[model samples]
Target: MQKPLLVTDFLDRARRYYGDHEAVVATTGERFTYDEFGERADGFAAALAERGIEKGDRVGVLDPNTHYHLEAAYGAMQLGAVHTPLNYRLTPDDFEYILSDAGVDAVFADYEYAEKIEAVRDDVPTEVFVTNDADAVEGDWESFDEAIETDAGFERPEMAEDDVITINYTSGTTGDPKGVCRTHRTETLHAYLVALHLDISDDDVYLWTLPMFHVNGWGHIYAVTGMGAKHVCTRGIDAGGIFEAVAAEDVSYLCGAPTVLNLLVDYYGDHGDVPTTGDNDVRVATAGSAPPEAVIRAVEDDFGWYLSHVYGATETGPLITTSDARRFFDDGSSARFGVKKRQGIGFLGTEVRVVDEDGNDVPQDDATLGEIVVRGNQVMDRYWNKPEETEIAFSDRIEGYYHTGDLATVDSDGMIAIRDRKKDIIISGGENISTIELEDTLYEHDAVADAAVIPAPSDEWGETPKAFIVPASGDPEAPGTTEEEIVDFTREHLASYKVVRRVEFVESLPTTATGKVQKYELRQEEWDDEDRMVGEG
Candidate 1:
């Protein structure tokens, strides 16, 4: 009854009980059983151990929603090595910073993103480079297919529940990226919570619409695998492909951000007669931002799939609250969409509170805005190599609670709705875009004097970055730079998703009495017509 909780146990249990069952449906039109998957993982672990990798070493994985990512992750975890996943959407510089900061020893990159890692290979500490397709990459990388063919075996080191097993780097706000260190206990509990709330089972078929790098696919990597569920992999998100896959593979469950829902809704509107589901009933979970009531209605009514809205941050297991409280609303009534729009009660064993600046819980009046804070076993233990930042994150406005920096209001029924973001970051299409990084990039331009970035409403993406610029010529009518030029400049420097979509030139920016730029003024003006202060809802 007191056995230590470890992430490796998930795969081990699945291998023992579900070895004969189908474990994965690869994007390459191939299927594998649990026994084959386990054998490949063990071979990969053997290869790493032969290459001098040991326990506590960082092993990086850079891939899309593919079976290779799952294999690489479990293989790293099997040898008690830290599994570090990198976002595929990030640029070469972002990868450089993350790989260097994490001190990754060995890395497995997909062929499509291998060139980015190759661009900064010398700068990072990574030694053993592996890719899915060595023929497609430019670097001298080992092939994943050959690497997993080794017949040798590796000895798994004994690990405790408190040992760090993973390091997920956060999207930096105003500074360098911070690695959120998670232990075996936190991951195991979070997986249990996800499986309970999402209702995953052995017969369920899971679609990898969500990226595996996103907080370990919102902890579904463990939850689904531990339950012996079938995984259907996809390389990228496409509305037509998702529909086709669901109908073909009989997908029962999936998760995505609100932007993915919008894409599906738009596709369904155009192709009215397209098949939405197969023989099995489908249930979807959406998060990252609140969806519009109309979108939620379209997903439930037109698509005929149940939608659950959840909320959390990368540091909080990315799933602390869910809006699936069936007791509060009748599914037959139109009022159910309103309840689903709020980030409902906290998950079991998780304490979610909206507190004021003085570390006191705010009244459940549904009008007073307060920062959302969370305390749970699934929360991160600390930030890697950054003691000061770690202390500030948990100690800000309260002790032992991770400050979410999201301002929200709690209703009388304990349902919380986000009103605004206290931080200067934009969540565009579920990707975090730092305004400071964009501003710094813009300042590098000769025609720009001062710039302020904020989130703007978008029907497609929940939010997009909008920049307000002060021209060096001190003239709003005839700024030295063009909006297209500013947007193009950001595209050249930052990642594709972080590019500025809207730009307005001004004579001078609105500043406070102390000469600090007032970004709230820009945000208020931009979101004046919206019902909520933040994006989407």
Candidate 2:
């Protein structure tokens, strides 16, 4: 009974016992049972194997939330190959860098995003390019449907527990992205933790609101499939589409960022109302920065769907703490929203602590700021091809804990509240924007003398990046770099979401004696009288 923990075990269970259960609902108006999904997954693996996919080969998946994406994940893992997820929101340069860096042997992309891969396909090391729509793709690529339709048998390879399963790239402190390597053991344990904390069961129907590329949808693919729950996959995040899915599929649970919640709340304000009991007891888990208390209230009170706020990063399996307030407080009380706002205790098997600079515990006075650190089976193994970053992440001053780079405070009731992000990261619309990357891009402009980037409050997005620029001592606004010019330069170099929203021309940036930019000074000025700190909450 002491076999190596493999991720395929979850899908195996579903195929073996829950063969007749409705497993997947695709946006293409097709449905499949557990047995059918498993057979399709094996077919995908067999197709890739025929095209020279072998153990340890890196496979990249670039698609929106779809049943095909889930099949790609399980298929890649089943063959002992590392499944690498590429962010479709990134620019062509980013795609090239990640694909080339990860040594991706093959890539499976959707129609809308496959063209990005085409932009950099010549330079990358990818051997096979497969797309969901072969007709839509202009270049040489294989058809996903044709591959899965084959009957070639797939041989399950022997994989160890510590074998790398997924490579999730993140915009870390450095200007370039870092690939966080997650092992089969890490994913298996993280899925179990998700099942326990989210209370997932076979009876629940999960709607695909979150992107499948994000930490493998926070590891719900394995957990939901293992439970034999039905999956309703969506292509996009429009409010109308979400409501339709909720009503059509009887969706019981889903996850998204505060931005998604804002859309739903805004849509209901104009169109009509949100259905709660008509479908199922809809429960939602929101992450990528906290949601405003008003939105939390609207989801719980107005719509009747329970809201739970969880917090974590790509390195920590993206799920460490949750704020299911009703479990600890009154259910229908007015103060429930306030209690639900706090990032509650760590999930099962996860160890979370807020500590000061010296690695000492911060007092639970609810006012002191400390960095949140985590250590558990759900944590990542290392950063691929970056030994220094891996060493720094594991060799935290606190020892045995991965630093989250988020500042928060714990209350007396053991509820944690985030105050600021220490990593200079802007979680705008659930996407991480690295300020260092933005500043480095600004430095490329000749008219820019110095620059600093910080998060600014936004109503729609959780937060947006605001750049403080010191022009190269020319005309204040006439000759040198105008705000428009700087913005244009950033758009050409960086992704659309990472572009600076607001630009301010400053005389001089506040700097330390060692010539370090004091970003906190700008942060304090920006968030002077904001209601909620990060983005909305």
Per-residue lDDT value at 12 in model 1: 93
Candidate 1 residues lying further than 4 Å off, grouped into runs, are 173-175, 424-537
Whole-model Cα lDDT per candidate? Answer: 0.88, 0.84
Report residue 526 deviation for candidate 2 (angstroms). Answer: 12
| TM-score, prediction 1 | 0.81
**Residue ranges of candidate 2 with Cα displaced over 4 Å:** 171-174, 274-277, 325-327, 423-537
RMSD of each: 10.8, 11.1
Q: What TM-score against the true fold does each predicted structure earn?
A: 0.81, 0.80
lDDT tens digits, residues 201-290, model 1? Answer: 999999999889888998988999999999999998899999999999999999877657866987887787989899989999988656
lDDT of candidate 1 at residue 84, scale 0 to 100: 97
In Å, residue 148's CA in model 1 sits off its true spot by 1.3
How far out, in Å, is residue 15 in model 1? 0.9
lDDT of 2 by residue, 282-312 (tens): 9999875556666787788778898888888
